[model samples]
Target: MKVRVIDNACRDFKNIDYTEVSANKICYRWQIFLEK
Candidate 1:
């Protein structure tokens, strides 16, 4: 499950702008996921 999330995140990341804001958003999302 975790791997799938990461894979999807990576794929999505590649399709979007690689900016600091986006990176932070992804990190924030992972933090939330980890908290759960």
Candidate 2:
């Protein structure tokens, strides 16, 4: 199945911190770098 990543990421994101963020963001960042 396909994922509306940004929307799902936003919904799933729970933790937010200065040093780091939720797992969703980390996954997206990896996708952006790897996909690009």
Candidate 3:
């Protein structure tokens, strides 16, 4: 049971990391566009 809980937590962390990376990429592109 403890192992299952740890696995779920790891998955959630990975998903959050992915979302943050995508957001950063979008923000970077917008910055470049505005600079032009």
Clashes of each: 0, 0, 0
- Checking candidate 3 for backbone clashes, the offending pairs are none
- Stretches of model 1 off by over 4 angstroms after superposition: 1-17
Where model 2 places Cα greater than 4 Å from the true spot, the runs are 1-21
Show model 3 residue runs off by greater than 4 Å.
Answer: 1-18
Q: Which scores higher on TM-score, 2 or 3?
A: 3
Higher-ranked by lDDT: 1 or 3: 1
lDDT of 3 by residue, 1-36 (tens): 554554554456556766766655655555555556
lDDT string, candidate 2, 1-36, tens digits? 124654455455543442235565665775575556
The superposed Cα distance between candidate 1 and the true structure at residue 6, in angstroms, equals 12
lDDT value, residue 3 of candidate 3: 48
Can you write out model 1's per-residue Cα lDDT over 1-36, one digit (the tens) per residue? 776776677557757877767766785687578668
The weakest ten consecutive residues by lDDT in model 2 span 11-20
lDDT of each: 0.70, 0.52, 0.56
Q: Tell me which residue pairs clash in candidate 2.
A: none
Give model 2's TM-score versus the native structure: 0.40
